[model samples]
Target: MHELSIATSIVDIAWEQARQQGGGRVTGVTLRIGRLSCVHEDALRSSFDLVTEGTPLAGASLAVIEVPVRIWCGPCNAEFELPGIQRFACPACGHLSGDIRAGRELDLESIQIAPDQIAADTPEAKQPEPS
Candidate 1:
């Protein structure tokens, strides 16, 4: 599925961000997906889980925010959300707006990361036994 590819890309982005920030574990990722973006949220989540396996984001979760379709009417000089996906006409003036202001967004909003923790096997993590 294409979601797998999208998931992989998301992991790549998160990994790059984490690396740039000096190496940390990703906790969550927030995405803004428009209704017209044609992405299946459930499938994307499942794909993300599958693609993150054995990666730094293995335990990371995805939060998807659905964005509604918004349009700008030229005749009425007004901006509003479409009543339905198929209806591109403005609700206020009933004018067909060819100017799409929003929606069709597939963007990564934010990424949540936890500070890197020292591994138990690391020398810095070893503790001396009490005398």
Candidate 2:
């Protein structure tokens, strides 16, 4: 599945970010998933677990925040959550419109890590040889 590839990319990005500041094991990753992103959360989590094995993010947790599909309705003069993908009409006035406001985000919000944790995970000799 593409989840594996997506997970791989996420890990790659997190790993690079962690490694940049000397080196640190990622503890968690926060992602914003949109309602229309069409990504399966369960599959993504499973793929993340499998892909993170043996990597810097091995024990990291994946936190996914669900985003709702919203549209701006001229009839109502406001934005409202869509009941479903197909119904793009104003809830109050029943006016059909396609003024989409949000719900297409697939982003990595942040990554958490501990410096000491990274040092502990690193090989001893690879570390500085006691000055």
Candidate 3:
């Protein structure tokens, strides 16, 4: 399934970010998935678990934030969220809108890592010497 590939990509990103921040094991990952993104949350979670095995994100929790589909109605000159995916009509003017403003996002928002895994010599952990 494509979800497997998506999960693999997420794991890769999280691992890279964690390492770049100083070689830490990810504890959690937050993703913003839009309704129009067509990504099933359950399937993605399952795939994440499978893909992260033996990796830095092995026991990391995956958190998904659902984003509603928003569209811009040319006739109404207004932006509103779609009540359902099937209906692309403007709620205020009842006119069909093809101008999608949002709801197609599949972004990795943030990642949490274990504190102990971070390098102590990093700039954030460094102490100033006496002048």
TM-score per prediction, in order, is 0.86, 0.82, 0.87
Q: What digit string (tens of lDDT, one per residue) describes model 1 on residues 1-131?
A: 88889889999999999899998878788899998888999999999999998887876778888899999988888789985789889999888877888889989999977777833233322223234
- Candidate 2's C-alpha runs over 4 A off are 117-131
lDDT of 2 at 64: 88
Candidate 1 ranges with C-alpha deviation above 4 Å: 118-131
Lowest-lDDT window of 10 residues in candidate 1?
120-129
Judging by TM-score against the true structure, name the best candidate. 3
Of candidate 2, the 10-residue stretch with the lowest lDDT total is: 122-131
Which 10-residue span in candidate 3 carries the lowest summed lDDT?
A: 121-130
lDDT tens digits, residues 1-131, model 2? 98888889999999898888778678789899888888889999999999998876776788888888889988688998888887888887888888888788888999987786545856533222222
Model 1 alpha-carbon miss at residue 81, Å = 1.2
**Which regions of candidate 3 fall more than 4 Å away from where they truly are?**
117-131
Q: In candidate 1, residue 130 scores what lDDT? A: 31
Per-model tally of clashing residue pairs? 0, 0, 0
